[model samples]
Target: MQSQSVPRRWLSLLAVPLFLAACGTPESPPPEDAVVRVVTPYTVRSLDPIKQGLWSPEWGYGELLMRATDDGRVEPWLLESLEPESPTSWQLRLRPNIRFANGNPLTAAGLAAVVDRHLAENARVGESLPGADVQVLDDRTLRLTTARPVANLPHLLADEQGISVFDAAATEPSGDIYTGPFRVRSLSAEELVLERNPNYWGGEVRLDEARIRFVPDPQARVLAVRSGEADIALYPPTEALAQFTNGSGPSVAVAAQPLQHLRAIPNLRKAPMNDLAARQAFALGVDYRQLAEDVLGVPYRAPDGLFPDVVDYALPTQRTDAAEAARVLDAAGWAPGPDGIRQRDGVRLAVTVLTYGSQPDTRTVAVAIQSQLRPLGMEVTIASVDDNYAAMRDPAGWDVGLSFDGTLGYTYDPIGPLRSFLTSGAQRNFGGVADPELDTLVAEMEATPDEAARRPLLERAQQIIAANRYVVIVAQRSSPAIVAETFAGYLPSSVLHHISAQT
Candidate 1:
């Protein structure tokens, strides 16, 4: 379903900000500098909203012209309306009286400039969508033309990866001007302070000010919540659930999010993994249920497929059978070696796993997998690296990679993640997993305009991956937050971070 108001509203800016502000009446306005403190494990890689802010914007400093609604439907935020002129071209109508935090009027030309800069720097968006071009017709109207019929253009513009509009004249030290409900007062690597945007076109800004502190350490995050140093703790150590629920400070809030899938990528270019039978045996062998329930803690479900349950075409949960796994390994000519590790022609079944050190959960998962595979005659070596991608590039460096694989595509479509993993020359395709059948399905899904029509194709693509065991699906993760009882209006989706006071 589409939001009708946004599709037509893009045509005219004509006194919109004034009309909306005057007609809308807020029941209660959030107090000035109310200061809701939030501590999260995520790091803001860049202070620039256009770069890092669009994804997490942990401090809630910037706003995109459009955003995905609670249900993953596209809705206009800064833009008054968005409509497609053609399969390749889209027109965006600006809202009048929209100003940045610095009191600068956000013009169409300025917005276009920022988008142009982003396009120049990153070739992925344009290449992925094809002929992605932006043009400003006037102060109120802007046009975007893709090389092909991309039905999800609005979702792309408002995507979490980037595409947030910032002031073209913004500097590194001063940061960029934002048009969101909250404006950045000051932001350091360690902490960020945001005040209400008085000029917000969305009517009364409910949050007057918010303090977001970066606490990457899970233990530190839990401590911040218990000590009342933070009003909310995001993605703390899964084990810390007891501390919050056991009358510490706040209650744990859990939302089932299939957006981020924890999967193991077997290097397709490497030795044992190059054989499809070995990869399939690896997938069937692991005790994924035990890993999710016992090791990863509660609220996280074992992943059935790459996409989460939210997507219409997500595959149903598969049954795990160790006997079948062992049979496949034996059939593949792998026999138990001297130390019980599988071997074939003097080669041992030893695999190296790489993961990011920042996430405590990843380490716990790796260890659990290691334990589970030992009985199956597999020797797993864990290497926690600062950069998982860096390790992935070296074919000889690692055999299996454990990480979240579907976050980027969660907001809109599965094509983004699918293309990244399956595309022949795609940068993020760590294992060099290339399958012609999978590529054809992905291309068809991408080209198809109707979501309903694309469903079957997407399902088929996922089925192919499952059957071939190109990647090992471990568990689908839910983003859990520990929040104080007083906090309210925090929408628990893959996207959205800002909150309102209970009162």
Candidate 2:
């Protein structure tokens, strides 16, 4: 199941924007001093950094103590320095005179409060830093201690979706306060308007205003950029990317690596998937190479392992064999029926795939998998839902789920994805896979800080996942954003928090 090249029809879809550009009159561009509008599929559900996770910092409303670069380096952002005092304790020093957008000074006490709030409110953060204690030594310095040794403490703080520094004085969730380059002017469900923070500790802010519009539809987001209504569009349809590359429309800004990947998690608690042979058959049936090369086109790579090549501990590519998949099913007592669908006893070899429209690629890949698995006598039914995460919670409803997994992108470490998705009782382990060996390996990786020493542990963890087929990785894709020709300094990042617009 490999494609030599993308199909002719996909290449034909590139003509859509060209046709629109020739016939329809483009809208007038905004004034030079007007707000720079950005259209995206994501919506801000809450103003609170604790509730919104990395979105607040990504939107320029807040800042973190440390930041991870595009090339896997963790450096001080809001902090002056971070040094480990002992295996279980570390000291943090914040830069002088950093203040929130609302003029409140950011202090060690405020950071401690933010940590406390995150530990209490955000389960993900609490899980990463369990029994963590933060003590303010002074206005600018603090000590963080954990019950167990956390070698990757800096990595945890640098996590895009991890702890964010906010104004502790403000008791309520308001967008007005945060130590960032921009302050919230107005916020609504549809859009968020931000103004330059004149008192920002970091150098002068460039953009006067930035407006982020939450447009759920991918085509609508593309239209917003095509019509000159928006200066930037995030996560547009991949087929329409050719229109931007010719310099007639928006320029395509791609991340260094394809950190985000499409993964299918099989429900381990449900029928068919609970059987290891069935899970292996499901993994073997899908044509991942064809999906990446033909359907997704350029910038998308075939499924390799849980993490991409950029990650040092990533595993080698896994091959798929439809014949082997059929043999595995036959050995498992699943026989092909009159309709060509496999069955064991009275139950048919059927699975309902769960996906969401927010990420159009999920639905596209799901449909492609449905067609590919038909030859293996596996019945794959795709169910497009409004909420992908909520829908996947019920293991009884869906046997397989298709969604974009960015765990490594958010944390910049293999431990992040392994611990969050593959480990036993992980926060995002919707598949209900409880492997004790994997759990122990992830714990060892967490405790071992040295990247060189953690290699073997990481390798074994990936092997367990591949052998068990706990999650079927589909494809890895670059984070693409369409930027207007007028804008000059918008850098696309694997971690969304690193993205910023400069005039």
Candidate 3:
């Protein structure tokens, strides 16, 4: 999923202007001439840096690296250059020109401090996978030696959560401070105000300040964009219904690919379902194309593999096969019953899938699945469970867990997710699935340093997952945002927000 479309005229030339926010002091009204006022949905879930998920672009709050984008690749933002001394070691050329918002020059010590702090900590993994033990080469350069083969390093360096180097003097050992484009100027129960970084080395930010107003309800998020209360609204699940300016003006909602991969993780721990046929029946019975396009109005193509466009090794699987599904179920002794639900021996083939949170048009899709599968003798049930997806992982609570696999493989290395499904992976037994074959593939993927040799193993592993029916992935699609036509400078890459500069 790379965008071949070049930056449009509106995206490149427009400078979205800003006025002094009312929240500022009388004397310090926000700079009349600041950067774009981007109104996103999420607020400061936690200022405690390491715990933040990719969801936290709150990178706006931190600074240590400068961002430079080249088409699809992310080069060093804080460091001027990088010289690999060896496979395990490299010397980083620190940026002398980069400065923290607090006016501290981005020296080797600051870079070293950022890396060293995470040695004992898990430092957020977003896409880069893991942090390493960094050795200070000198005041201007540092050497890093990874504990293992960290192929995702380059992508990680660009991760706003992990790679945005932090200023040492700004925080206590607790690890919270200002680093990126803005700092939290004020916070009340309802709103958060952010101010520009005078020492910001990135470039000129057009807004004097941005007021991040929180809107929890999905409807309110849409309303904010429609009413003009918010200059930019995020995660507008109801974008289709709302009018847009892209072609139609203010009558629209705005956002970009925020997250995708809404999926169903079938619990392989139970019998019958633990049995392959039951799972296959579930996979083949539901129609995802209808769910994505007609029901949701937001369209997406069926993915050939777990990772569609961005991840190269993911190969496509066979399309939904009702005949195969029926055959598999019959072979498993689940024959159609009087009421359409299947019954095997003495058991009725009833499975419950837990879901929570509404996005765009999920209710309709879930309902359609239930209706479609009933005739197959499989009774499918959908329930809302937003607060805890782990409950679906609970052996006693569900037969299938319905949730999006947003990061899936993109979150870290392919292994970061591969390890999760392994017999010993975290978020364990999401489907309570354990295959010796999958375990072996993931193991090789983790230990094998060479990606060339790992491609087949990775490909085969994805096939095993689909073949095993541990999951029935709906159409693979990333989330989309309708950015205001006036917004620009943001280049969306395999890595989102590599350069979300509002020009």
| Top candidate (lDDT) | 2
Root-mean-square deviation of candidate 2: 11.1
- Our tally of clashes for model 3 stands at 31
Judging by lDDT, tell me the better candidate of 1 and 2. 2
What are the candidates' C-alpha RMSDs? 7.8, 11.1, 8.5
Which pairs clash in the backbone of model 2?
none
For each candidate in the order shown, give its overall lDDT on alpha carbons: 0.69, 0.78, 0.58
After superposing candidate 3 on the true structure, give the runs of residues whose Cα lies further than 4 Å from its correct spot: 1-35, 45-75, 79-93, 121-132, 157-164, 171-179, 239-247, 251-259, 299-301, 358-362, 407-412, 422-425, 482-502
Model 2 residue 169 distance off true place after TM-score fit, in angstroms: 3.5
lDDT of 2 at 463: 86
Deviating ranges (above 4 Å) for candidate 1:
1-33, 41-58, 95-97, 102-107, 122-130, 137-139, 148-151, 169-176, 407-410, 488-493, 496-503
Per-residue lDDT of model 3, residues 1-503, tens digit only:
01112111111112321122344453355544453444556654434444442332443545434342423234665667765555555567876677665676766766666565444354354223343566666778777666555544554565555654655454321112444666555544456566666766677765566666667766676666566555555555644543563564333322233235667777777755777888888888877667667665543555444655455575776356777788888888888888877788878899876767655344556787888787777887777665435576567767876666653433335665566654544565577666888887776665555668878988888788888877766765544444444543332333444222243
Q: Would you list the rank order by lDDT, best first?
A: 2, 1, 3
The alpha-carbon lDDT assigned to residue 116 of candidate 2 equals 76
